[model samples]
Target chain A: MKARVHVMLKDGVLDPQGEAVRHALGTLGFDGVEGVRQGKVIELDLATEDAAAAEAEVREMCEKLLANTVIEKYDIEIG
Target chain B: MKARVHVMLKDGVLDPQGEAVRHALGTLGFDGVEGVRQGKVIELDLATEDAAAAEAEVREMCEKLLANTVIEKYDIEIG
Candidate 1:
């Protein structure tokens, strides 16, 4: 199974990386560009047969290493 | 309105950041976790009323700034 995890900064959290990108875009002449918040993406190729178990494992992966739960939340998609 | 942009590395591309996180998670006792691909998250508290135009702007943002289009792709959601 394959899964994609998108972990993003929560509302009201500061994102300096995204801000930098937004500014860079403005410099690059992308006039419509506004704001950007940068986060992490995790793609997993698992050998497990259980999607439920994989979700749990991935959640633990986020909590422990992939995300700073203090300021970010994650969404998971499995295929 | 707010929009969320998730940019992820395409399959076959190297994601050293995610691999590092996955290794760290394993070290931290997340045993079942397998692979990880790190990406960028952009959160926009857009002031625009047009979701379609905003989506276009964000797509440009991703192409020009938030993601390295050479190896990454993005998805945008507006609310």
Candidate 2:
């Protein structure tokens, strides 16, 4: 099975990197870009038998190590 | 218009950050995880009248500033 985990910065957290990119984009005449928030996607290939089990494990992976709950949230997509 | 940009490290590029996350996930007993690759997603809310033009400009944004083409590739999704 394959899984994709999306980790995003919490709404109130300041994302300087994303901001910088946004500024640069605006300078290049790509206006109408309200803002940019940078997030991460982790693609995983699991050696598991059941999709349910893999989903549960990947959720743990995000909660424990892949994301910082203080400033981020994660969602998992399994295939 | 709204667009989502997915930027991924080139297959051969060395992603130390991702490797570290993989190692930590492994230590947490999430076994059978072969490896992990990390990427970024930027969701854009465009104040534009046309999707085609916005996409072309965003592609330029990726090429010039949003991602380092030396070891990255970007895909755009408009909705």
Candidate 3:
């Protein structure tokens, strides 16, 4: 099975790295870029064949380690 | 318009960060965690209402700034 997780900062959270990217884009002549939010993608190749099990396991992984649940949110996709 | 870009290392590329994450997960008792790859997701808010134009502009940004065209590949989604 394959699992993909997207970890993104929650609304109302300050994202300095995202701000830096936005500033860099402005300097690179992409002035129309209004806002930028940067996140992470984690792809996992699992041995399990069960889609439901894969999703549940990956969700646990996200809650335990992949994400800072307080300031960030994560979405999981299993295939 | 909104644009989401996913930047990932190409196959056969060495990803020390991903390896480290995998190792950490193993130590945290998630032994079934096998191959893990990490990437970046960049979300942009643009001024243009045209989805095609927004995608084109964001593609340019990815090619020129957001992604290293050498060892990384980027996919852009516009809305």
Candidate 4:
């Protein structure tokens, strides 16, 4: 099975890297870009064949290492 | 309007960060991890409501600033 994880900063958190991108975009003349938020997408190739088990295991991975639970949130999709 | 962009390194590219993650996962006792790849997901809030135009603009952003185009490929999703 394959697992895809998207880890994003939680709401109300400040993202300086995203802010820098937004500012650079504005400077590049692409106006009307009101906001920007950046996150991580991790793709994992697992040895498991069961989708349910893969999802559960990937979720555990997220909680243990993939995501910073206090400041970030993660979503997992198993295929 | 909103646009979501997923930027990933090309298949042949070496991803040290992902390798480190995979190694860490093994050390943490999460076995059966065959491989790992990492990417970026960027969300943009646009002032325009037209999805078509938003997609086009975001594509331009990717070609010009968002993606390296040499080692990275980006996909745009307008919502």
Best by DockQ: 4
lDDT by residue for model 3 over B1-79, one digit each (tens)?
8899999999999998899889988998888877999999999999999998898899889988999989999999888
Instruction: Please give me the DockQ of candidate 2 compared with the native complex.
Output: 0.79
Which candidate do you rate higher for TM-score, 2 or 4? Answer: 4
Query: TM-score of model 4 relative to the true fold?
Result: 0.98
lDDT tens string, model 3, A1-79?
A: 8899999999899999899999999999998999999999999988899999889889889998999999999999888
Local accuracy of candidate 4 as per-residue lDDT tens digits, A43-76: 9999999998898899999999999999999999
Candidate 4 structure quality by residue, lDDT tens digits, B1-67: 9899999999999999899999999999998999999999999999999999999899999999999
lDDT scores of the candidates, listed in order: 0.76, 0.86, 0.92, 0.95
Off by over 4 Å in 3: none
In the order shown, the candidates' DockQ scores are 0.55, 0.79, 0.89, 0.93
C-alpha lDDT (0 to 100) for residue B57 of candidate 3: 94
* lDDT of model 1, residue A5: 83
Instruction: Give the lDDT ranking, best first.
Output: 4, 3, 2, 1
- The per-residue C-alpha lDDT of model 1 at residue B19 equals 82
TM-scores of chain A, one for each prediction: 0.91, 0.95, 0.97, 0.97
| Cα DockQ of the candidate 3 complex | 0.89
Model 4, B8: alpha-carbon shift in Å?
0.6
Taking chain B only, the TM-score of every model is 0.89, 0.93, 0.96, 0.96
